[model samples]
Target chain A: MVISRILQKTGFYFLIILVLLFTLFPFVQMLSTSLKHQYDWGNPSLIPQKLNWSSYSELLGFQKKEVKVPESIHRLLNNPKLSAEKRQKILDRFTSTSDVFPFINYFINTLLIAGTAAAISLLFAVFGAYSFSRVRYRGRSGIQRGVLLTYMFGGVLLMVPLYQISVQVGLANTSTGSILTLVVIYVVQTLPVSLYMLGNYFRSIPESLEEAAQIDGCSRFKTIFLIIVPLSLPMLVTVYIYAFMIAWNEYLFASVFLKNFNEFYTLPIGLKSLFVSKNAIWDRIMAASILTALPVVFVFMTFEKHLIGGLTEGGVKE
Target chain B: MVSHPGSLAQQEARFGWKTVAPSLLLIALLIVYPVAYNLYLSFFEVKLSGQNEFVGFNNYIDLLADRAFYDSLTVTVIYVVGSTLGTTLLGLGVASLMNHKFPLRGLVRGLVLLPYIAPLISEVFAWQFIFDPVNGIYNHMTVEVLGISDERVNLIGTPGNALLVVIIFDIWKNFPFAYLMILSRLQSINNDLYEAATLDGANRWQRFWNITLPELRFVVGAIVMLRFIWNINKFDEVFLLAPNVKTLPIYTYFTAFTGTIEQGLAAAIAVVQFLLLIGLIFLYIRRVLKW
Candidate 1:
């Protein structure tokens, strides 16, 4: 009996360790490679020979070490009669001013746009979900059903017509126009699920609380932001995280609308451009990859306490 | 402001409309109109010069006649079914494991979700490197660690091999979602059921087979169908990881966005995919979700 109990414990721990290893190995590999020097690229070991932090430093804009430029830029700069404006333009290639993987710029752009869109979606969904859940109205259930239906619509169906609509509205060429277009599109993509999640969570909050709030002189609108929204804080965070991620990681529509606007590139587009432009440097690529994912993971972990799985009972993945 | 019965009801209805108006307006413009516009565009040969000639059913004819369309359809079916089943099962397995007591169980749970939580761009790069022929850990594992083979394995280079790689990649990326849903329901299940089963002389496996599986059927069914719906529309997952694997989204992407710019045909393909998706969603909501 003792032997059987020991064997069962060993088996259980073995499974746990196996799962941990499988889940973490890729991340470990990526981190290891990001810290490796150029010579260590061929090494299969998880640890670098000497840990190199230059990629992270450079990517995060802390250090400005002069790296080797491509031969084409060197060749262009060698011309003696090159105009000063054009010469500085060519030299700006190495600086953050030029088009070379501006990680900071892209990071800021993604943060502002995705963050703003998610905030807007969350604020609206709070009200929409409140109405959908508590208020009695005609066609209310029909609209709820419709929200789920729209959520199910494949994005590919919208890409072409959406692009056309953006173009027609003069929202495709300029940076602000594209930014607005992406915000609207992101809101559309994330709103249904946000409403769905908050609605489910809101419905669970007892109506007696709202009745009490109303009896205390709060209007229905104020009652929501004041009482209801505060009550569902965890679910609200869950909704914001979901909405932010949808906009943050979105690539399909971003690719179409922002193709011509390089300065306004989101991370997904910027990262793809990086992959295309600099395919050779493993350290730089992996470094940007790590940095791009850091903010989301940080936000998630900081709010990990709210990961009450019950909050997302029927909610599927974003 | 206490009012008559009909007046208060009228005021509540108006408040509901006022609250949801922004969402409804945005939905109408972006989703509803785009859906209708896509259907309308399917009937025309959309050109760059703003002269869209009505092509009627010809675009659909061309799409049906094209061999690549059929090939991609087959691949999409396989990819969706394979990826969905893999995620659901793996999710159930992992959730079941973590449901039990263990050391650092909370940490392990968080770490497992890392795959799902990581950004696609970052994860895709890691995966691309992992499948890299020369220095990838995949090659290192199969060739050196496990001694499964001596030659370096190239999983994403060829079309047939690429499909399997993308499906596996998707499973790794998405299973946490199913795990999250199932584990919540699993925890809610009453322990009395299990206690009774044990007292009735049921073995652990038999108890799990009878009670746990039946309890999870609804959640699992909803998850599997939702995965089916989402996977069919997935683009960046496969595109960023292995651009060569032409699932339907990528297929439509190539058609509409690039390479010949046959917008009409692409629109038709999207229309068909949307129709199929509507059917699936209705079935999912009515049958699995029972909404």
Candidate 2:
């Protein structure tokens, strides 16, 4: 009986190890593909025989001439005192900068859009979640329902009208408009999950401590910032990281909304472009894909503890 | 913590809106406005670079008549159903395995979440390469190991297998989410009930069915409804993996933005997606809110 039990347990663990390989094998393959030299797509090996950084270097614009913008633009104000020739020279320098990968602009645009949207949405969601957790209100139940139900309004449904509105508002071909629009979408979509996690954490904190703070003549808001925020910092970071990851990885909205603006393509869009580009180097594309996913990967690994708490406690209720 | 109940109620009400005001305002402007506008657009004969005219239900009629629309509807249904079933069953299996007090269970559980956290584009692309006709690892393994020699089996290129492969890919990527939920819920179950069941000569299957199943019904119901709704409106997985298959969301995209640029028809399709999503959410609310 003991030997049979041990065999079964060993088999279970062996199966688990296989599952881990299943989960992580693709990433390993992608990394291997990325590290292969430019002309090695035909080799068809899991392990790269030779490592090359050329694809990555090309992506970061290492092969491009540097743009020397006038020191005036770097200054607080524009210097109109500069000659037209000097201004033209600066413009010329900017235009003359030639990137090798041809998608460096898309990279920066993605970062700006994802980074800004994540940052802003996190700021709003954290405060909103805190208030819902700590405060009492007549319509709190209704508001929470409303917030949760809003996610049912999938972005695909809004694509057409959003396009028209963007065109009308002169934001049709801009990255800022897409990012702001996405931030709004993500904030509402993610708010319910964030609130649920935070509310759980907040409830876990003893009310006696808050009462003590109240007795000390602290305002409710002040007490919250001073007490609860400090205690819940890990979860707060977890929520922010989750929100950021979602924003970064989002593609459907980014694909439809930012089609006309090549310069405004986010990492997801950039990766898709790699597939469809004229000079679609498979190795380089894989390299770019690796780069795009690195941020989210890092976030997940670093915050696994808080993420598990947030998720298992009902963040991913779906 | 405030003393006055009467004035404090009003103050709390004000604070509630104050805290939620920015998000509400943003939702109203972006979500509410666009939804309303889309509804309006669906009713009109709108076109790109042309004046809009009121054509009540014509767009809907045209879409309903279009053969591709029906195909897309069917595709969307199959995709959702297949993926949901796959994920749910796989999740159940994994959760049961984790329910046992095994060594290294914590590490294995954490590692299983890798699929859930990976970026969709990268992972989906990886799947694409795995199923690629010439050099895909899947084909190589099958042909070499399984002794099946079909000449260059294009899993994604053929229509029937294409959708099936997409469903497999979706399930592979998403089962971890459901597993996490079930495992957590399993951990919270009281062992006393199981102990009683065991004392009553209840075998493993009997205990699972009688006690475990009953205890997990609520979570399972909620997960089912939520997963159904989510998978139904899903765009990214299907759209990216099998763009040619024309799921509802992908079809809508092509109609409106990419291919034909049929703005009115696309708006109509979008409305259909919205109504379906809302109906699912309402169904989910009725099930979950009972608790």
Candidate 3:
């Protein structure tokens, strides 16, 4: 019995290690490949022979040396009275490099679009959630059910018509248009879960507290802002993280709508473009992939519990 | 007093509408309008220049007869079933192993979720590199280390093997989701039931079959159903990993945007896929969720 138990434990740990290796092997490969030189691409060794930072430097736009301004132009650079166009031209001359991985603009665009969309969706969802949970209005349950149905009817199915509509409405191939479209789709996509999660959370709060606030002559909006919002900060964060991740990782809509607009491409689309681009460079691609995944992985690590909770909550409930 | 109460109710109702209007409007515009328009477009021949001519049922007829559509449908079925079953069974096995007492269990559990939570593009690209014919580790291992084959195989470049790779990728990427769902439910199972089964002289396999399998029935059902709905419509991973592996969504996309730009035919394919999805979702909602 003792021998068998010991054998079982050893086998269990072996399985655990196997699972870990399977899960993490690709990630290790990505990191190692990102640090490999161009010639090291086909190296069979897991660890690169020599670490190289060229991929990172090139991707983050650090490889380019600052352009030297001529003495006559150096005087104009110091002039605050320089016209905006002239200033832009001077800065462009100083900074432009064809060797940089054309991702800085895309990265910033994704941050702006995803961040703004998450914030806006959360703002809207708060009101919608509060109404569904706290208010006793007609058509409340019907609307809630509608939102749930739409949640399951995801945006992928609507891609064709959506693309057509965007084109018809003159919102195609523009940053502002894509941003606004993403914001709307994400709001619709996320609002259902945000409402469901937040509504359940709000319902968990004692009703008497809101009643006491009302008895103290607080208005409805004031009661929500003062009494409810503070109590549901964690749920709000979960909703925001969920929405932000969806927007950040979204590929289908971004691919279709922003196909012609390189300036508005998100990280996923940008990474894909690199893959399909002629003369594909593996090290730089891996570097960009690592960079694209880092922010999300960091977010996941920090808010791991909330993220898991938000996902499994619907499943775990009775 | 009666007037005051009535006005207060009216104000509350108005506030509710005011609160929900923005979200509702956005949903209607983006989701509802597109769904309605997609249905309409399926019946018409549409051009890139916004031209539409009523072709009533021709797109659907042509799509049904199309060899590629049938090929993709078969691929979609095999992919979905393979992935759903692989992930669930693997998840169940892993979850059972995890239920045992172990050192560093928490860390292992957390780390296992990395594949699921990491950016899809990053993971897909990493897999692509790993399976690259010339430089990939897969080819290196199979050819040099294992000596399984003398010649390197292009896993993603070829169609049949590409689908296999895609399925494997889906399982690797998604089994974590199944693991999470099953593990959460596994932790909640009563220990006394297991002890009771043990006292009855039941072996581990028998105890698991009687106690654990039944206990995990609902969660397993939920996860499988959810995976079905998701995998059937999955576009990004397959599209990114191997565009040659033409699943329904990728096929629809290519038909609509590339080649001949048959927007009408693509809409029809989408409509059919949407109908199928509705059926699966209904099963998920009714059978799994019981709502």
Question: Pairs clashing in candidate 1?
Answer: none
Q: Flag the better candidate by lDDT, 1 or 3.
A: 1
Residue-level lDDT of model 1, residues B1-291, one tens digit each, is: 455658988998999999999999999999999989999999999988768999889999998899999999999989998999999999999899989977788888888888887899989988888889977888888888899997887889988999999999999999888888888889999999999999999999999899999999888987887788889988889899988999888999999988789887888999988777778778867976787
Candidate 1: which docking quality band?
medium
Report lDDT (CA) for all predictions.
Answer: 0.86, 0.77, 0.84
lDDT, candidate 3, B122-193, per-residue tens: 999889899988889999999999999999998899999999999888989888888888888999999999
Tell me, by TM-score, which candidate is best.
1
Tens digit of lDDT per residue, candidate 3, span A1-318?
A: 999999988888889999999999999999999999877889988788899998788788887755776888878878999988998888787677654557788899888888888888888888888899889889999999998776455455789898889889888757678668766766666667777888888888998999999999999889989999999998888888887887788888888877777767889998888788773788888899899989989988898888888777751110
Q: What would the DockQ be for model 2?
A: 0.52
DockQ pick, better of 1 and 3: 1
The DockQ assigned to candidate 3 is 0.59
lDDT of 2 by residue, A1-318 (tens): 999989988998886777778777887778887788756654558777888877888787676545566666645235668777887776765667443455567667766766666677766766677667777877777877777776566667777887788777776656677666665666665666676677678877888888899899987778778888898889888877777677777887787777767666787887887787675766777778787777777878888888877876667622
Model 3, which residues run further than 4 Å from truth?
Answer: A65-96, A315-318, B1-11, B280-291
lDDT score, candidate 3, position B60: 94
Ranking by DockQ: 1, 3, 2
Chain B TM-score, model 2, reads 0.92
Q: Sort the candidates on lDDT, descending order.
A: 1, 3, 2
Cα error of candidate 3 at position B255, Å: 0.8
